[model samples]
Target: MQDGNTNTPEVETETATDWLTQLKNVIIEYAPAVIAALVILIVGLFVINMVVKLAKRVMEKRGLDATLQKFLGNLLSWTLKILLFVIVASKLGVETTSFAAVIGAAGLAIGLALQGSLSNFAGGVLIMIFKPFKIGDLIEAQGVTGVVKEIQIFTTQLNTPGNKLAIIPNGSLSNGNIINYSAEGILRVDHVIGVSYDADIKQTKEVLMQVMQANDKVLKDPAPTVNVSELADSSVNFAVRPWSTTANYWDVYFKVLEDAKIALDAAGIEIPYPHSVEIHKGE
Candidate 1:
């Protein structure tokens, strides 16, 4: 029984030694490849960062859109990193064909799960290509009127006139109507000024014309119009139309209205107020 116990211990020791020897052989064969892969990974990461930075710089110099610049830069960086990883795996003795098949399957699954995101991505690409409107443009879309702050891959940002920020989906924006107020260099400002029915219609028109002419921002070519548009119960309304550059549209609009009121007041033109007369029969 003692001999049997000693022989079992010897057999266990030999088995342990053989396992260690095989492990050491495997490590010896793969050590160089593993080290190479590590070096490539580190160097590739550094290079990929540099490439992304360089791409951004170039886009900036070329005056590309900020949204497009950021998206393209990130895409290039990710693609290069993925390719680098594949190369590293190959160098480390991984079956590249099987690895690529697994990656393809994962990509397919992700694509299926992100259908909405993919649609938005396609919309973004279409916007970049067609360029219906650009950043800083004042546009009305999706029931929101605002300045375009940014055009992102999945959404667009708008700064509303009320100082509110609106986030709109790119898919809807691309498919919907976008009224760009800033597209045309010039815009027409329309206003209705009312005067008492007793006031002289011709005199009121002259006063309005003078007001528009005095405002230097108003365009001279198209000229300004002052015509009797409506005769109402309380007052006669005149349509005042002026053309101004988009940049100075609001200034011309407000200035003309104020100046017209002052001119009419100085000329003794009456601006009537609302009035009602009530009568009671004898009881």
Candidate 2:
């Protein structure tokens, strides 16, 4: 029994030593490959990052659109990283074809789930290519009016006259009618000046003409027009139409209005106010 017990221990020790030796041999054989895979992954990620930074710098130096530059940069970085991951996985003896198939399936699922977003992205690309409106252009579209602040792949940002920001989907913008108020260099100012019905019509017209003429910003070629537009209950309405450069349209409009009032007041032309009549009966 003692001899059997001692032989049993020796056999167990031999087995344990053999197992250890085999494990060490396996590790020695695969260590270089494992290390190389890790190195490849780390170096590949670093190289991808550098490439992305370089691409972004080039885009910036070229004055590319901010949104487009960022999108492209991110896309390139992700693509390179994914490719590097595949290479590293193959180096580690992973099945690259199976990995690619899985990635393709996931991409298809994501594309289906984000159909609307993809449409907006396509629309944004079209907008960037055609350039219907640029940053700072006052535009009216899809029932919203504002100055374009930024254009992104999925949406566009607008700064409204009331100082609010509006985010509109690019798909909606591309599909809708866009009215660019600033597209034309000149804009027309339409105004109506009402005077007492008994006021001299010719004199009132003369006063309006003088007001338009005195404003330097108003266009001269169009020859500002003052014409009888309506005969109201208590006043004769004259439409004053003037053309001016868009930048000066508002300034000229307000100035012309004030000047017309002053000219009419100086000329003794009465501007009628809304009046109500009162009656009394005695029995």
Q: lDDT tens string, model 2, 7-94?
A: 5878899999999999999999989989999999888888888999999999999887777788888889988988998898899889
Give the whole-model CA lDDT for all candidates, comma-separated: 0.90, 0.90
| TM-score to true structure, per model | 0.80, 0.75
Worst 10 residues of 2 by lDDT: 1-10
**lDDT of model 1, residue 80:** 100
Question: Which tens-of-lDDT digit does each residue in 25-123 have in candidate 1?
Answer: 999999999999999999999999999999999999998877788888988999999999999999998999999999999999999999888888888
Model 2: lDDT to the true structure: 0.90
TM-score: model 1 vs. ground truth: 0.80
How many residue-pair clashes does candidate 1 contain? Answer: 0
